[model samples]
Target: MRLPFPSLSTLPPTLAKPPRYFPTLISHTSTTTTPYYRPLSRSLSHPSQPHHPQANHSTTPPPPSSKMSSPAPAQYVTVTPTPSGYALLTIHRNPVNSMNTLLWSQLQAALDRCEQDPNIRGLILTSGLSRPVFTAGNDLTEIFAPMTSREQYARFWTVSNQFLARLYRSPLITAAAIHGACPAGGTAMSMACDHRSISLHPASSMGLNEVAIGIPVPAKWAQLMATLTGQGEANRLCGFGKMVDAAEAKRIGLVDSLVDGEGKEVVADAVRWMEKTLRLPDVGRVITKAHFRDRLSREWEDEEWLRSEAEGAWEMLASDEVVTVLGGVMQRMSGKAKI
Candidate 1:
């Protein structure tokens, strides 16, 4: 079904009102500092002016320069507008586009902007790098770090859940153009999209590899997997953490279609389908999709998947075996440890 795009210039008057504020009571002090009420008046007097605060004897010490000068985190995901009114978001982080915390946050922000933009009718999610790997999944280095805390892990998982959930529920149609290895969280990402077009390269691997990392499939991942390949398939895939080749993925319906050769044509074909299907008069496609998937997502939301992720992260961090195994994998790959 075709969804009408909202005009930005014609937004309702209610949205143009002054920013709302919540009232808070502040404790009074005898210190000779400018009162908050006076600052409010000054702000009203010169709405467009900037004010620099002067330090007083009783004022708190300024935070270190390093803190003030810290740069905003870099955006790992790149969004490019296409002529087809759809955008392509490429996860460009090198050999394996592992979804680190920074990448996850960036992805959410990109999706948010795309969803709000009237010109963007749909989106094609893919990696920037060529095949042999689309994404190897979450950054094992971050996941297996010694200093990683349960709270941090939980926050990471929560972020991932929110990002994936939004993609699944986006008002615009979404498609995943996968070329190479997409394991663990990567596979979950493809499944979250409305359609997945994969390349049939021998090197391409796809599956849920969470068990290998010693974590049970969280509710969101499990639900998406189940949606793509039934409960039985999802159970086996998650339980075994098996990585399937491209051919096996298509055979089992894990992937919607396999692109010939290197899969460069996959995105073009997906774009064609999106253009045709998105124009359908009936909005049932989008409505039905949301109806079916929202039920499962709600179950996940109720379970508090973020909290579970944090707990799992804490447990994984506390495990010397997990740390040793991950370190050994990295060292062996680098020729610093015996295989």
Candidate 2:
């Protein structure tokens, strides 16, 4: 079944006229300040506009600048509470929904709102684009050295992973509907969810493709993938940085349900699947999820360990070799330099 994208006119007033920057919200009770809001765009990317990357890591500050200029409130994400007792929290950072620091915070804001609300029984996470790209994953700026400071990279690492940890442990039912390419950070987000449904659309594929970009998949992210797809399979997939197509993803148990449609249909099916989970006793389901997933969240909360990882990520980004590779990839993605 095809579910039409929600137009601003038909959406609730809150969404139609979203507050400037999505308000600061707490993830696991810790507040984050991420100022951004971009009006939605439909195309993958146009040269006239800024390019979004499918890069890894997050944040521009490995060493945050005190004089950091705040971006205008960008609407990279949206939330629509459905009558079906679930809310659709979309990642709409157009041009492939790159997981930048701003997009991450906006998403966390939306997720926190849902988790705080009693009326919402579940959250369905999906991309909001006419095309099939679920999310191109990490925004390149977060990973690019010349463009990002050590402080900024540090923040990106923290916010991005923290959001993933929170999603993994969220009490509300969390589901991912992947209608297209999902790699690295994208896989991290979906794998953290309680369940994932992917479109069998020809263009669709999902995996942890970090190595291909000259990066190691974060240990926690690899562990989460391992949890879902088994240690052995995850080892193969992650080690090779394979972005598996729908059939392989299903076969490997990387994603739970395989919807035979694109865009709205894929997400619609995920909603249906989540509804069944919501029908069960909430307390029981929430507890069961925690029993299996809480350990990861606790580990993310380890300041010393997280800082060490961030430092490592920072060191890598600062390396000349990785910088050149990322720049080349960015040039190709932005249509500036062809492969």
Candidate 3:
């Protein structure tokens, strides 16, 4: 039977790009009808950058790229305040830049700093270096970590949602420089910002895939998407776990515009947009942002509601459905199951 929405397998070539960057494989024909494989990419000769386990095993892939080094401890999330009036928050988590509790805490601190500083009129969020993933959502390993108590789980969700809520309602203008595979939590963060500029590369895509993995999308997250892309598109994208590339994302208003290159170039594009936004009157910008986001602000401020939502997040993680779905995802990630 045909499916209404395309699965990863049946999606068109445009939508079939892998979430992670893999080395390209070269093959030659032989009389035995078996193809021999060799990996080729610019990163192969570079000794500094190590390849992750899941590369090159997929059915043919892209060429090898440059080596990406993990930044030192103090560089995880760099907050650089410019003299010209804006702060840049660069996400530097290495080996797929996944968000864990620590990163979220650091991010929250950065946002707080930006908000409090009168000189910092706006903020920009982007990956620190030239890496494949621009914050590969929540670090799945961390999310699925053993929870000794429901309170532990609730606390995790609370801090995460709090950061997002802060970003969504920040008086300063915010923009996301999304250059790579931005899914799940990453998508939510991008949507929370005022503007998003995604890279114009095939691998650069963004969407909320929480439901496909059996976890419900938080109500605040759903509202954020609906606020950005309208209710119909938000419903389709969230419900189906649909991932779209940069061009289509722009067309549907998931992202504001597309940047030409990856890494620093994407960050530069976003900074330029933020600079433009900052040219407007600060009072007008701040007031307008609060006005449109009043509903979200109200919801996040409701103490009981916040606690209940956090508890719901914990319960979902503890559910058997999420466990089984995560198992399947792990299988696929480990090359034990076909996509």
Give each model a TM-score.
Answer: 0.75, 0.78, 0.73
lDDT of 3 at 253: 92
**Model 1: per-residue lDDT, tens digit, 1-339?**
453443333322211111221011121122122222222110011123333446665456566678455564555687787766778887877657878777777777677566545566678888778646677787765566564666677777777777787677665679888887888888888888878888777778889877775556665687677777789988888898788887888877888777875656877767777787667532444445555565565455443556765676567666888778767666655732111
Instruction: Give candidate 2 regions above 4 Å deviation.
Output: 1-71, 335-339
Which residue window of length 10 is worst by lDDT in model 1?
38-47
Model 3 lDDT per residue over 72-92, tens place: 433367778887688778887
- Tell me the lDDT of candidate 1: 0.66
Q: Model 1, 147: alpha-carbon shift in Å?
A: 3.8
Q: In model 3, where is the ten-residue run with the lowest total lDDT?
A: 20-29
lDDT (10s digit) by residue, model 2, range 181-254:
88778888998888899988888888888888777888998988888889999999889988899999999998
Q: Order the candidate numbers by lDDT, best to worst.
A: 2, 3, 1
Number of the top-ranking candidate, with lDDT as the measure: 2
Comparing 2 and 3 by lDDT, which wins?
2
